[model samples]
Structures are given as C-alpha cells and as structure tokens.
Target: MLRSFSYVTDHTGFCGTIKNSASDFVVTEIEVPEHLLRDTRAESLQKTSEAQLEPSSLCLQQPKKQRTEPPSPCAEGCHGGAPSPSERDPSCAGGDCSASPNKKQPEGEPELRSGLEEASMLDSLLGKPMSELLNKFACDLKDAWDLENNADAATREFSLGPILDKKDRADLHSAVRQKFPFLVTVTKDNEMIVKGNADYRELCQLVTEKETSDFFKFLDAKIENSTFSFAPDGNKEHRKVVHHFINRKFGRLLETKSFTVTDVNDQPNMSIMVRFREKSWSRKRSAGGFQEKQDLYTDFSYTGIKDKKAITYQPMVVKKVTPERLKEIGSKMEKKGMRIHNIHSACQHLRLGQLKGNHFDIVVRDLKHHSHDSSADLKERISEAMENVETKGFVNYYGPQRFGQGQNVQTDQIGLALLNEKMVKAVKLFFTPEDTDDPVNNAKRYFLQTEDAKGTLVMLPEFKVREKMLLRALNRYGVNHEGCTKGWLNIPHSMRIFYIHAYCSKIWNEAASYRLKIYGSKVVEGDLVFSEENDESVSLNDKVHVVTAPEESANKYSIKQVVLPMVGHSIKYPSNKVGQWYHERLSKDELQMCKFRVSPLQLNIPGCYRPILKNVQNLSYFLEGSEKGIEIEDNHLNAPKVSLHVSFDLDPSCYATVCLREIMKCDF
Candidate 1:
C-alpha cells in the first residue's frame, strides 16, 4: 500500500499530538482495509543466524550520519572513533562532513557532550530516518523491525471505534466487545506474548475540528475525604469514577489518588442538576416529511407540559445517588435502553407515583386562551361550578395517564391482565412494545407472537434486554406459554408494581364511579371522609375510614375529607349500601378484598385511600392585561387575549386537570 509522507530531514511541524506519549510514534490510523490487514498470513519465515542480524547491527546502532546531519564544530573530536581529517577518505569533501586533515591546531582539554545533547542524539538516532547505504548495511532500519526475527516486545492501545448507536456507546460494553474489532499488540519483538484486549495503554487522543484547545485541558477533579467533586457539563450527566466522556486521561490517577471509596456511603453523589432552564435545539418536522428547526426548552416545571412557561425551573432535589456515568458525546446515539433510561432519570424526570403529599402548588395558566366564554360568564360559571363542587366535590378519576396517555391506550388493560394472572395476555401486550420505530424489534415481536421463544430470543438484539430476559426464562425451562407466563416474574419490579398499581387504580376509579352515581353530591352517613382537621390514625392499608359528625362546628357541611377504598387483602368495604355494592362487585369476579396480598413478589400493595374531594386554595385568575402572569405568549393567541392566571395548592396526588374540568367545564 502507498503512504503519503515525505522523508523530510527536519520534521518539526506537527501541531496535532495525542495525549498518550507511551510510544515515540503515534500511529494516526491508516485505513488499511480488509484486503490489506486481514487474518490471511504469508508463508513461514526463513530463520536467520545470529550473525546475519546482530543486536548492534539493528536500527538501534545505525551510523550517526543516517540519524542526523554531520556534527557541528562544537561536536568536533566528540566522536573519538570518527576518522581524523588526515585519515578520512578523500571523498569527504570540505563541507564540514569531515574536518580537514591538519586544520585543528588548538590544544584544548578533553570535552564531553552535555546530557541534553546526548539524549537528543539518542532520540534522533533511534527515531529519525536513515539514509540508505545498501553496500555495507544489509537492510534498512524499517526492515529490521520484522516480528518474525528481531522484534522483541509488544504494546496494546484502546480506543473508541466509530459507534453508530448512541445508546450502545459505552466502551468495553458487551455490545462494544461484539461489534468493534479489538486491537491488540503491535509487533516490536519476536517473543510474541499474547495479551488480551483489556491490556491497553493508559492515555488517549482527543482531536477537534475547531480551533479551540479547551477540551485538551483535563478536568479539575478534587476528592477530599472521599467526596469527589468535578465540574459536570450542562448537556451530560454527572459521572462516577471520572471515566467515559470527562476525558479518561485522569482515569489512572483514580487508582493512585486518595479517592478510593472504602465504604458504601463514601460513594460520591454524581447527581447533576439538569440544565432545564436552557433551551435545547431539536429538529422538528414541519411541512411534508422534512424536519423543521425549533429551539425546545427543557420542561422543568412540575405541571408536566412542554409549553414555554414550563421552562422555568429549579434543580430537582434527588434523594438517590446517581449511578450512571456521563455518556461521551459523539460516541454513540443514545436512543434506547438503560442509557436513555439513565439519562431520563438524571435529566427528564417523570412526575409519577405516590408524591410526598402534604401540599403541592398548582399553577393553572392560560385557561382563557382556550376559553371563549366572557369574563363575567366564566366568573359566574366558575362560581356556580365551585359552589356545586363545594357541595358535590370532584371525582377521584385517575386521568388518561394511568392507562398510558394516548389514543390506543392499553397499559391499564395489560395491568389488569397481569393482576388476574392472565400472563399470556400480559406478555403479548408487553411484547407489542411501545414506540415501535426499530424494524429489528418489530421482527422479534412477530416471532414472539408466533410463540417461537427460542427463535425470538436469538433474533432479539442484545439491546432488547427486557425481551431477552423473558425469553431466557422460557429457554431455561422449556419453550411453552406456561413457562413464558412464569417469565413475568423476571420483569422489572417497578413494572410489576406498575401493573398492580394500575389494577388498583382501575378498581378505585370504578368504586369512586359507583359512589358518585349512588350519592350524587352529598356527605352521607357511613361514608369515609378525609379531613385535615380529623387527627385520625389511618393505616395506608385502611381502604376506608368512617367518621362521625365533627364537634368543631355541627352544622358545617364542608368536605374536609372524602376517602374511598383501595383493594387489598386486609381491607374492608365501607358500611351500609356502599359496602354491599363493593361486595357485589368483588363477588362477581371471585376477587376478594384480601386478594391484593402479592407478598411473594414483595409487591404487597396495601390499600390506600384517595380523597374524593380536594379543595383548591389561593385561587386567582385574570384576563390578559388585567393581571401579572396572564401567559398569552405561550397561549398562541395574540394580544387582547384572555389568559387565566391562577395559582392554588392541592395535596400531592390530586390532579389539576380535575379541578380545571370543574372550572372550564371542558375535557382537555
């Protein structure tokens, strides 16, 4: 193969230098294609005698003339073995290549070369090119480096090969191991000690297309008393062990440095507050299939929407230490799996589950943008609605999200299927994975549908970790629907929790529906009432808590609390007709109130009560210019628009949507 490089005598021009100085020569990889450096090898080497290739005869002991220019006047007489002017061959013309025969008449004392000069001479001798003198020297310095004969030692280096998928971008991961061809040892010796892929050089090269050398500077990491602190980027997640994207240059220092975590608590909190205040650039589709430009701000507000107003945020207070390492930008596309999950966990948080519910501030803005009703009309409507709400109270409806929020919603159905031990249905529902973009997964799902557990397992990419796990259970026992059903146990505990929670939510919603239907808007006797004033000892398992008339004020009809049942093994139906109705419903399905005791899975969902009534406090709203907040810009309406600026506090787990439905009288 041909290489594009000149044999220049003076090579002092190389701005690009790899951070790793392990080897004297940095091999900027030449694209030696498969045709060039394949596993195919030449015939066995013809062994040579020790006389033909002596240790001193190799490139290490090449003539000084071959390594550098002839010595200067200060270097004169330094090479004692060098022939004098009188003894020098006549071909040594007087160009300082050799001194004239009798010209040096000075009686100076013996001089020795400085250490710097000696080292320079050695470097030049070892690394520089040699002029060919084939007459005496049998071979060039490059030719003597044959691994078959004179080569002695080997060195291996690690590098991130070109990664295509961002999610599978972690170095040394199983995917990386399987995909990238691991590079090992360059032949410097004949001893042929075969070291593995893990035996790698400590340092790496980082090159950028831009002029700024900012990335070249290593991170300023300080670990005092086991607390590691380093500046994390706004784009990347904070990392543990200081590896991955933050320049692995300091990785070796982690071993020698005093930051070795001895105790579990000493593990550093790598959680970084995601920069949600800033805008993220995204390519959005506009007209046709073309992608349009858009600056999407991070949704930091707790309202769970992508509107501009939601961009205002504070750092999320994380309770758990971040266990994920920062993904190296450009290493790979992080579009799926644990990498994306971790990124989402570290950055975009999903406001779900049982929120710590003392109080939650709800900001309902721009209601007027969508509301065409007049101010007085809206005010009268809201007043009447609130009065009605004060009397009847809000329905305890678990919004569309509980069932997976979109048109073909079915997660709740899947949850019920699992709860009922309809494992096949649950597996089928789950295997038809959401966000179907990858064809490979689609194919695997097809095989899974065919009940070819083994085939599907093989076809499923390693990245389809969840699917592989379920299929592995099937494979381990035997390929059958029953074994596959048993594989549901292998699914994530969080997922199992979700299924049970969804089932509980569904049951609760139905019971609430029945309650609403029977007693339309009145606090009846034997009804469980949730009251902040009622200092009652309520177990989370207590599905329904009965209450007597309050002594604070006998005639007061305010709904301080409206509690409903959550199905559990230890729970009981409410008293009177409501309790009878719950009994009838549970009896039909052969489901006991105590059937929710999923103790074996440790998902023992102790029933809890959700308030059937929630009071909105500090409620206020205004038309466009009438108030401070009126968010018209985000409302997509021009000026003179009516934008409701409302703020109120509701306990955690209460949906703002339900309250909005009462006020706006519209389904969003």
Candidate 2:
C-alpha cells in the first residue's frame, strides 16, 4: 500500500497530478539495434588495468594492516546498548580493521615466506589452470587496489574453481592474502573467491564516442567476448540468473550442465557449466573436429521450476500468416487497450527485456502551487526540479503496478502465503474483495459469503479466465487445502511467478531505501556490483562482486553500479549494516536465507541483485495548454491549469511512474 522509497536528489519537486486520461501516458518500446542483437555473448574475465603497472604502495608492497576479520554486523551490539566483544577490541573497530589497522598480518617477510611455502603446497594440489586463475586474481587484486587509490571502483570476484579439500581451500585463502595482502577471500559452495576491485575506469573507457557504427561494433564485440560459462566456478544464483536470462530470451537454444559432487566437508556441492547447445547436424559433421569434448556426466538434469499450465514451445507449421489474421489480432488487442504495429517477419520470437529502452510521453494534468506564486515562478521551480532529475537521477523502485492495482490483498501477500505453504490461505487472499462495486468484486464477495464455487463462477465475467479456472477447480475439488492448492496450481506459471517476483520487489525496495538512507548514494565497503549485465534478470548466477575496501574502490563506482539483493538462498549479503538489515527484515517474515524455496511447489527463488539508481535518457519537459478539467487557473478564477508535458527514455523494466514520482516529489 503506499510504501515510501528513497530519492536520489534533494529538490523541491514540482507538485502535480498525472494520468488524467488514457492518452495522458504514452509509452513506446525502444528496440535494441539489430547489430547489437547479432552479438550477445557474455563478457570475459577482467583484464589487469594499466594502472597496475604504476608504482603504487597497494600494489608493490604488502600493507602492514591487512583486513582479515569478517565485518561484524552487530558492531554496535544486538541486545543492550553495550558493544560486543568484537566491537570492544581495537583490532575489530567498526568491523573494518583486522588486528589494529597498523598490526602486520604475519609480522614480517620471514612469516610471508613461510606462508608462501603453504601457498605452494596448496597451489600444487589445485592444478595449473586453477592455480593460474588464483595468480590472475592476485594480479586483479593489485590492479583493483591501484585503481581504487587513483579512481574509485567496485570489486570483481575471481574463482579458483572448486577446492574439494577444506584444509586446502582454507590454506589457500590464508596464503593468498599473505602473498597478495590487498586481496580478500571468501568461500562459497567449496569454491574460493578472490575478491578484488573491478576497474570502473575501464567500464568508462569501453564507452566509445562514435555512436552510429564503431560504438555498436565495439559494444557487440565486448558482449560477445563476455563470460557466460560457470563450468567450475561462480555463485549458483549468478549462474541461474544468466541461465534464466538466456533460456527466456533464446528459448531452448542453449544447454547447461549441473554436476552434484561431494566436497571434503562431506556436503554435496554443485558445479554448473553453461554453453550453447551444438546443433545435431553440426555434431554429426564435426565428429573429428570436436574430439576434445568436456565430460558432461550428471546425476540428474535440472528441471528448474515448472509451470504445469505453461504452453510448451512447439514447432509451428504455418505457411504464412495472412494480413487479415494480423488485422484480426490487432483489433482484438486494441479492445484491450493495446496496439500492435511494426509487423515484420523475424527468424525468431521476441523475448522479454530484449528492448534497449522505453520512451515515455507523460502528461501531468493539474499542477498545484502556492496562491502567491506566479506562473513564471512555478515554471522556474519545475524547470529546476527537472534539471535535478537529469543530473542526479532517481531511485529505481518498482512502481505500485508491481504490487497490485487497487486490490485489498497485495500480490506479495499471496506470494508469502504460497511460500509459507498455506495454499488455502493464498487462494483466499487472491479472491479477497477489492472493496469495489465491479462484477469481479461481487463474485469475490459471493465466493467468500457462500462456499459455492459454481455460484461464484456464474457471477464472474467471461474475460476473467483465471478466476473462472480457480472456481471450476474449487467446485470439483472442494474448498479444503488440497483443493485450494490444486486450484492454485491450475493458474498460469507466469502469474504465479509474478506474485513471487512482486514479493521480491517489495524486499528490494525496502533494502534499497535502507541503503540510500544509510549511505546516501555513496558506494561503501561491502557494497555489491554486477560483474556482468543480465538485464535485471532474477536468475543472476551470482556474477556479483563485493567491495573489499571502500577507500580503494568506492570512488571507482557510480551510484548506478551499486545494487541490493532480492534476498534468497544463493545470494551473499553485503558485509555491512544493510546486509544485517536483510536478516532482520526476513526474520520478521519468519523466513531465513535457506528457506527461500518452497520444495513442495518446486518454487526456488534464488534472488538476484537490482541497481539502486537509474539515469534517465533524453529527458525534456514543457507546459501544455490547460485541459477542460482544470479546477484552478493562473489568476483566471479557474482550477490549476499547468498541464505539464514530460518526455524521457528509460531502460527496459524501469518504471516511468517512479521517475515521474521523483520529478513531482509527491505520492501519486
């Protein structure tokens, strides 16, 4: 219901109303360039920045103070006002210090040499490629430190594959830091991650000035070389995000392998490898050429979450779709307030989030202003607010549409019920009355008052397909938990996932607000940044990096790079207060990090990260002629006549409503 999200800019926003009519809000999808679409390969490993060659203290010499301790979430204490033991010790002050910021990690080069001996033992066990990867990470760490000092940046995580040996992984973690004191190491699913800052300056450099041809070419090449495989490394969520994005965008054009192997800890660990599925004909023709195939033996193929009601992707046998058929479809869509145009033949179907951006032409109806303020003064103030939006941008909160539109029960509430496995409760919440006089609400009331599903079905309109299905299922199965669950399952998979995603969006908004409140757009230590762009997909297979040291990395990242997690089993919480808030917030919901899955329904929400801020493109605003509905006028004894016309472009999935809310600085 009216949750408050943080703002990026501090400006006296132009107070106004919007969406007075259907024509008031116009949106057009910005198609991705065909050239860019030709090449969509993921990015490669980050190269060592040129700054690494410079003689920086962080790179050349081991800093005496190497941060070794984990950040204490409760540095200020949990229960009483007293600080915890870790907080009391000077060695762990602010959770940023290791052992007194001046204390040497191993005390000298003699100890460092001994640590190297330990490193050698571990390196021998890791094999050449993984060992080389570790070394690469060390170089990356040096580069990060060097870059952080010169320019603020975010960290990128490097994998040392999966270290099956617990002792070896631990030794490597300790020894690697001893050798490269600037680096921080973390273990995830038996894999070692060498945390180093990513060079955001390189991110900036990748943006070329030549837009028409050369820039698109470079961008396409850059994306093509990008990494999508997580054969032996990467966070499961990160891999899943990539996997889901690819799967959703390209259908079943690619294949991935998930290997479940036990580690030294006697726990099953997953190693997934994602690659393009070779065409059957290609495999037959290249028998000799593709000899060295990676062994893809597996325990079981991961089915992921399946929606029983989803339409199976099948080969369509169509000679040609007639113009009359297209017109028929267009007419049907127009009745539903949607228009389909730009008809063309395509080799493939268009997938979600394939667009470059969206262009918005929003018209604000009644503008409220002080009685004493003149039209020119109001225009100046509005112009100033618009400028602030262009410069500082706005928080990219999921707008109210994501929650639910004028409903008594939010989608997330139903999602929470589903997650809690109270299927009957979830079904009940879905059918809850919206306090409206519409036929749908009347049907809901009839269903609630009388347990006659058949009667409710009679009252529902023909357009209410989901409602009718649910009622029919209930009429057949009865109103018990078993019946309700079966009825719920009858709903489309897309709608079920939408409810769940809405719940995720709720958490993301809260987390984003907390982060903004705590840090105020500042990238701090332990903040997360995406190693690759997945176009805001939830199946982010953990391709995220932790900011190891803010002083060295914060300056390198813009507010756009910083992101907050959606909170799931596969995600790593930030090693700071915001991360702590995730736990505290989830605790209130009676949920834990490991409980993000509803095993019975096969619903696994391995959450992904979302950027806190989004910069608008091609923003422009102007005052339009007064509409007839104006209640107040500019010294003309009429209503507010300032009909503000605003236009801007935003990346796909971004909310124009949120952007408008930011500009207006009012709850709409």
Candidate 3:
C-alpha cells in the first residue's frame, strides 16, 4: 500500500511524501483526495490487523500533500456540508491521532490523527531529516527483523563518548545506580559502580571499612594527637601526610646514641627495655680532709661515684678496667726505687679496711714540668685531663693518694694530737680558777675564760688547788683574779705565798664585778637573819619590823627559814593543816575579788590575800560549774585576778639564799 507522509523543512512549508516499499520513498504533489484518505485508513487498519501492532502505529503515517500549497489532509463535509472527520470519531482512535485533518472512516479514527501529528512534531524536534521520519515504519519493521542482533553492544558503543570522561562516568554511574538501584558492583579492575540501592550500600560499607582500618593504622603510628584532611575524591593523600608527620616527629627520639632500647619483647606493641650510659668516678681523701699526694691503688669493687651537683653517691658496677701495664709500671717505679711492696701494702690496706683495690690507671705527673704553673692552673689542667680521659671511655682506675718521707704519717693522727691539746686547755680552764676560795665562782670564771686560754693551760689537780687559793684571796679582799690558781693553792702556805702574784694579775680589776662573792652569816628557821650592826644583839621582838633591804653585797647569804604572817593568837602558826586552810581561803577570796572587779558581783575582803582568795573562789566556781553542766555566763565587768605564793629554803654549806617580793593586783 502507498503510505502518505508529510514533513516541514527549514525554509519550506510541509511537503508531501509517499513510501510504497521498504526502501522507496518519493515526494508528491497531489490535491486532496477523499478516496485516497479512505484507502490509507483502510490499509492502516489492514496492517494493524495483519500483525500484532502497538496502537501507536496506527497514527504513524501522514496524509499526502499538494505541491506549492500548504500541505493538509483531505477533509470531507467540513466546508461543503458533508460529514466531517470530527463526526466520524468523537474520540482519538489511536495514540494522539484526533487532530488529523482527514475526515473519513470514523469519528474515533481522527483521534489517531492527533497522535500522528504529535509524533511528527517530536520527530522534527529530534533533528532527523524528513527521510528518516519517512523511514520510521521500515525501521520499526527492520528492528523486528533483526531481533537476534547484538543491539545492546551497538547501543553501548554509541553511548560511550558521553559516558567515558571522568566526571561524566561518575555522573553516569550515579544516575544509573540511582535509577536502577540494583546493579552496582565492583568491576574486574577494582573500579566500583552501583546500579541499585543495595549495591551503593555495599560500596559505602567497603569504603568505610577501608577508611577505618587506615585511620587506626595511622593512629597506631602516632605518638601525639593529630589532625588531618582526607582527599574528597577517595585518594590516599591524608595517609601519606600522616605517615610523614609521624616519622619526622619520632625519628629524632630514636636517634639518641647514649640511650638504647636493649630488648623488645613484641613487635609493634610491647614493652621496651632501655639502657643508658653514664660516666662515673670515685674521690678519696686523707683523714685530715685533704686529697692524698700519691697515686691511689685502683683495684676496687664498684662503690659508685658521687654526683657533683647533688653531692649524693650513686652505686655502679665496673663493667671494664684498664690499669697500667704491670711490667712497665713496676719497672718505672723500681727506677725511682719506689718499692712495689709499698703499692701492694697500700692496696692490701685499702682492701682490708675500705674495700678498695689498686684498679686505677697510673698517669705520671712531673712536678718539674708543672713547677711554673699557678695552683689554679694546675687544678684546671688536671681536671681537664681527667675529663678528656673519662670521655674517651677508659676502664675504672684509682686516683692519686698522698704519701712521702715527712708526710707519710697519717694526717688524722696529727689532727688528733692538736685537738687533744686544745681539749686539755679547755678542761684546765674549766676546772682551775684565778679566784679559788669560792670554788663555785672560780669554776664559773674558768668556763667563761676557757676559750681565751688557747692550748697553753693543762688541767691537773695542782691547777685546781691554785685556783681555790686564788679564789680565797679574791673573796677576802673583795677582788677578782685572772688566771687559774687551783694547782698553786694545793702547795703549802709558804709556797702559796710565793705563787700569790702568779695567781693574781692586774687583769682582775677589769673583771672584778663578775667575781664570786662569799659570806658568813647565821641561819634561823630556813632564813638568813643579818645583824644591822655586827653586834648580833637584837632580839626577835626588837627586830620584828626591821626589814632587811635587798643588797648587792659581796657576801652570799643563806636563807634558813620562811615565815608567814600569824593569824590571831595561834600557837605553832596553825601547823600544816591550818596553813593549808589559810592558803586555800586566801586563794578563794582573791579569785572572788578578781571576778567582782570586772563582773557585777563585787565582793569585799580584808587586807592582804584579797586577790588570792578571789582567784581561788572564781577558779573553784568555774571548775565546779563546768562539772555540773552549768554554762558560765560571760561577765565583761567581772575579771578574775591571779595570786601566786612562792617559798624557799636556803643552803648554808653552799651559801645559797633566796628573797621573796610580793606584788598585788598584778595585771597580766
């Protein structure tokens, strides 16, 4: 059947075309023919019935057009009162075909015309030439004919250009996976692509796992907290950056030479054992606190060296030793006639007592070569040399020890002798006295002057005698004597006269006020009663109110008795019990008066012991009330006064005396 078709060109109006065979197409100029439209419709219906076809195919063809005129389908009865194509079909018969210009067949048939027109419009928009549109029916038929052909391969090859660029490929995969959401997979080349939601999830899981593992490995390598950025495009830039950072930071720590990790029990994660190298040495000195002048024997157990800064001893093990070559060293010593026996003896002595042996290396120091050097220069040179050798890592060696002809004696023994002499002088100065009559005063003077005596005086029994006689003479004349006379006083009277000048010196005049004083007095009832006139004629009643004034007398007085005021006409002064009662009463009254002085409760008392009695009363009240669980109210107006009682007995043999003075209302 001849199928009519129409197409619009860029510069031409719609033109008519016709296809009679699969490959034959021709342009035509024809007027509208109703029979032809009817024929075309019949033929389309026949084609549709002959084969299983899509409803869209019925509107695939267009009506023939006329030449030099606007192409239009032949419509019947529209302008000439004939039945119109709209009347033939009230609805579209096929895909969007109702708009067709042909009026024939049925009302529903024209509906298919609209679909044909829409298809034509779409085909034109697709930029295909009218020839390709004309060949659409044949193309569709050919697709059916080549059903077994590799169409997918051809389609894929054609689609490659648009999909192959980096960005485009990624976008393509994203779109495909988003649309299909089921076909995603890792490619044979390890490239990942997703076609479904589940595939995308799997890809994401793999990526997350990889990233997590990498992150942990990175953290394991890091000693410090770090921040890093990962490439947005799944590149490993962040990993490389972190690796470099870790290596750089930790590399220096690993480079220390003095410290080494000696043992590692596990790879990657394990405890490391480390050892550090330290330089050490020992220092020895003579008992006199001086460095020895001779070479020290070095063979010794490790007793660790002292840290100069902390001045603390650190213990160490001697890992190695390099003493002087025995033959060469011994020969040199023999040339100087310095017996090896001496060195051996010193070593044995140090070993036996100090647990040290001659393990030290010997370095001969020539005095002649260093004679012109100052002491500081020599010291610096020695220190620098020692430091340099120590830094060179030599084995343990002994330092120098001092020994010589005049100096071979122990320095400590000499120090001991000097100390002994000073001690003896100190003892003599303490025991012997310039003024010896008063033994106690002389002893005090000796102690005070001992430091000034130097080491000249020696303590002896004779010196003590001289000290006593001198003290006696000074006591008699009321003079102080300088120098010890204890030893001289032990001599006979004749000899004592001879040593009098030796015992007394003009130096005594300056120190006389500090001299000891002695006195002879009578003691009565634990009190020393001095006679106003040397007559001693006064009776007790006559001396009742005669007060003995405190004096700076040369003589020392002994107190024989202490007397309290009598109460009423009590015999025996009320004995011990009454005295105790009186004391308690006085204390109580004094305490009460003290409280009343500041409190609202002012109590009165007779003369003497008022403060004492009040203090005792207040104290008793406070203690008693506190025990009874009664709170004592604070009384700002009633402050308590304290009273004190003191008594003493004198020693006549030692000439000791004490005086009591009473103070009343003593604040604070």
**What local lDDT does model 1 show for residue 668?**
42
Ranking by TM-score: 2, 1, 3
Give candidate 1 regions above 4 Å deviation.
1-393, 407-409, 432-445, 454-468, 478-482, 530-558, 592-594, 599-602, 623-648
For candidate 2, lDDT tens digit of each residue in 158-209? 7766654444555555445444443456777876776641221221222211
Give the TM-score (vs. native) of candidate 1. Answer: 0.42
What are the models' TM-scores? 0.42, 0.56, 0.11
Error of 2 at 51 (Å): 38
lDDT of each structure? 0.36, 0.55, 0.23
Per-residue error at 441 for model 2, in Å? Answer: 1.1
lDDT of 2 at 102: 14
Residue 379 in candidate 3, Cα distance off native in Å: 61
**Model 1 RMSD vs true structure:** 31.1
How do the residues 499-597 of candidate 3 rate in per-residue lDDT, one tens digit apiece?
111111111111111111111122222122223332212322232221233321322333212222212111122223334444454354232122111
Name model 2 segments beyond 4 Å from true. Answer: 1-3, 41-320, 328-340, 370-376, 532-542, 550-554, 627-639
Highest-lDDT candidate: 2
RMSD to the true structure for each prediction, in A, is: 31.1, 21.8, 61.2
TM-score of predicted model 2? 0.56
Q: Sorted by lDDT, highest first, which candidate order results?
A: 2, 1, 3
